[model samples]
Target chain A: MKEIVVISGKGGTGKTSLVASFAALAEKKVLADCDVDAADLHLVLNPKINYREDFSGGKKAKIITEECIECGECEEVCRFDSMYYPDPENEIPCVNPIFCEGCGVCVRVCPVEAISFDDAVNGEWYVSSTSHGPMVHARLGMAEGNSGKLVTIVRNKAREIAEKENLDYIIVDGSPGIGCPVIASIAGADLVIVVTEPTLSGQHDLLRAAELTAHFRIPTVICINKWDLNPDIAEQIETAAKERGIKDVGRIRYDTAITKAQIMKTSVVEYTGGAVSEDIKQVWRNTIYALG
Target chain B: MKIAIASGKGGTGKTTIATNLTATLASMGKTVQLLDCDVEEPNCHIFLNPHIESSTAVTTPLPDVDEEKCTGCGICAEVCEYGAIAVVKEKVLIFPELCHGCGACEMFCPEDAITEIGREVGIVEEGRADGFRFIHGRLKIGELMSPSVIHAVKIAGRESEVVIIDSPPGTSCPVIEAVKDTDFVVLVTEPTPFGLNDLQLAVGMVRALGMPFAVAINRSDVGDNDVKEYCQREKIDVILEIPDDRKIAEAYSRGEMIISAMPAYQKLLETCWGRIIDIHRNWGELTS
Candidate 1:
């Protein structure tokens, strides 16, 4: 099966909106929203979850206070500054879970062995049925890290389901930023579509996203959403893409109906066969052609 | 008060509000600093146009194993949490991208062969624009150490009286690292289903960290009233509201700050800062 992942280095560039439209247009496909920190594809897909699984990523260190040595060895060795003394006068170092990277430096340094390393639940994932087809998505717990690991799990599960159902495509909605999560989403994908707007930030992040795809040796194309918002910048982006050997698959004009369709919980293609829908269809067609 | 303007969703006017508000504060004769902690794709430089006074590489440590002293007993590999190390036939392999540089491997190595070395992951820049200080980070492409760069940006400008941080969009580690120590946070979001969903996640994040926060809705005229209703039910103070304005969009596309592009927004943003200060003062004694 052919795999395509949609990402935008800058957020609010219509990545989820385009992925939803692709789900409606594609014949047989499984959707996976790898943007766990902000998974918004489900808002429009309306998935009926059939399978749920809790995802545990890495381990965290907890200070065993009762076994207290009060030696302050753990605090001295930690690089993340996760350990802090609640009371400066006379108190044991408490673990700030947010700053803790689960590096286990404190656990190993504790001379009295007063620390325990254990797995922590980071989030949950699901296999669900939607109007498009079976989909895979996840919800990250609040104040949790290791989002890259969870994204990998979602991708693997989506691929497995596609293999079982003999699906033709797997369209993944990836997160913004060129970080661990974005890398995990594009690692083994067959194609990457970067959706950007005509703003200055959009132009800047588009290059960064393209550089990431190039680093991974993944074939990538560009889709300019809300192109009419800044036609001059859009034209400049086209020239820049040409110089970088990237193709402009589509340039969707700004449409108020796009958000209106989102409020209705439907894709643009399903809501109306208007100009914006045609633009997205063109993106899909050009993308499939490029994949060949 | 030190405040971070953040959103769970991107393109929600976090940078716009941050730049304009800081400019307005500068006009009001406040000592302010703006730090763009969104290392991967920092856009504040595009609008603010600061003259970078200095550029320095932000480095992360990587374990360099001495082949002769290395017995490859596998203790280092066993202790690694990120799977960045592997021992094969008395040889070691290191995946630089996967390493978190927590000094776990070197600390646990029994053979005394492992040593830490520095690698450039990104760069931190310090500058100024219009009488206010500016700092930001730019993470190298294909690198995963954005949090480290973010930490550097925060540290570089921690002493300002009115510090405003423009954080990357998300509810995960990078976002947490940016907004955690700040006294106040402004969660910028739109009024749509996606916007509301992501905003809820961002809210839960700041709340988990025990940080006081408010909401700012962009494009408030277009979407449903679910976001407004959610904030009201939760008693979240709606600090700023900017309706769908094409002129603002046009100015932003040209990399122009709102306060500069349209002088009319000067009073609006100044008033917005007034609310932030008022709300923060009500939270009792301030830290730092």
Candidate 2:
């Protein structure tokens, strides 16, 4: 089985819109949304969840007030500052769930053993069915850490489903930036499709993403979304791709229909069979060939 | 008052709001310090064009195991949750890239063989831009953890009365670190489907931190009304709405702040800042 991840270093560059079109065009494929922190692929795909599973990437610290000696050692030792003075009225060191990194440093340093590691329900992953195929996705709780680990879980689930059904491919929509989650999504993937816009920031972020891919020695194909927005910058992007030895798969034109499809909760190909769809179809074909 | 601008997703206009807000405050002759905490991709520098004075490298401690005094007991491996240390056949390898610098391995070492060493992960640069003191964190390539550098940037700019922080995208460790002790947080987002989804995440993040915050929706005319509806349902204050305008996009492309290119936006940002202060005051009253 082959895995192809669609990632854009910067956000709002049309990664999901392009992935939705690919899902509509691809055959016998499983889909995964690896942007667990703020997943938006479901906005377009609208997957109906089939199975839900609890995800605990790490532990969270909770202080037992009754057992407290009010030692304040945990507060002094915490580098992340997750422990704080509990509302001066109470006047005890407390653990802030949002700030905690689950490092267990505070828990270990707590002289009274008041602080302990507790399993935190950081997020949840779901295996769902969309019109296109089966999709795997996850939603990380607000302020939850370890999104990279959650992305790995969702990707592994997608791969497991693909293997069970013998799907030909797995299309993954990755989060923005060359951060932990994006790295986790593209790691061990067969190929990476970097979707970028034609702008200065676009070019800069695309280069950063390409650098990350090259570090992992992953084969990459570049797709310039809204190529006409800044044709000059688009040329620079193409040149940079050549300089980096990354293949420029194809260009996607500016289209209002893509947004229209998103509003209707459908893929662009399903929304309109116009010139933009044709361009995306060509890009999809080229991407498959490049991966091969 | 230290205020931070953050969002759970990228491309949600955190820098746009932060830069413009700083410009607005400076126009009012208010002393403002703007710190860009999005070390991995600090774009506020592009908009602000701060004249960088000096930059200092930010370093974190990683365990340096002494092979000469090693027992190869693998105790370090068992103690490290980040999987940065491993013991293999009388040899110990340390992957400094994965270490979070909690000093757990050294604490658990029975032989007293582990020593903590520092490695530079990024740089914190300070400068003046648009009449506001600016500081930004720039992470080195291939550095996985960015909160350490962000912490350094925050420490470098703690004296300003009104410090505006531009936090990185996502509702993870880095964003939390940026918004931890802020007096108020402004969650910048657009009005699209992606915007609302991420706005919800950002709101939850801020609420979890127990920080007083409101939403500033940029590109409000581009997408659907779901963001507005969600804010209304959740009783989240929509402090400002920036319409989708070609002028703003053109100005952004030229690296000009919104209020700078469109002088009319100056008063709008001032009004938003005032409302933010008001909300924070009211929040303090309620909580205290």
DockQ scores of all models, one per candidate? 0.86, 0.61
Q: Which CAPRI tier for candidate 2?
A: medium
Provide the lowest-lDDT 10-residue window in model 2 chain A: A82-91
Of the true contacts between chains A and B, what fraction does model 1 have? 0.88
For this target, which candidate reaches the highest lDDT against the unseen true structure? 1
Question: Which runs in model 1 stand beyond 4 Å of their true positions?
Answer: A87-89, B284-288
Per-residue CA lDDT of candidate 2, range A1-292, in tens?
A: 8999999887778888888998999999999999888898898988999999999988888998888888778877776777778578775777878777778877877788887798889889999999999999999987888888999999999999999999999999998878778888998899999999876677878888899899888889899998877778888899989988998989999888877788888998999999999999999999889977
* Candidate 1 local lDDT, B1-288, one digit each (tens): 789999999999999999999998888898999999999999999998899999999989999999999998998888888999999997999999889999989988988899999989999999998879999999999898799899988988857679999999999999999997899999999999999999999999998998888999998898999999999998889989998999899999999988777898899888888888888887554323
As a TM-score, model 1 comes out at: 0.98
Model 2 TM-score is 0.95
Model 1 chain B scores worst on lDDT over the 10 consecutive residues at: B279-288
Chain B TM-score (each prediction, in order):
0.97, 0.96
| TM-score for all models, in order of appearance | 0.98, 0.95
- What is model 2's interface RMSD? 1.6
Per-candidate Cα lDDT values, in order, are 0.92, 0.86
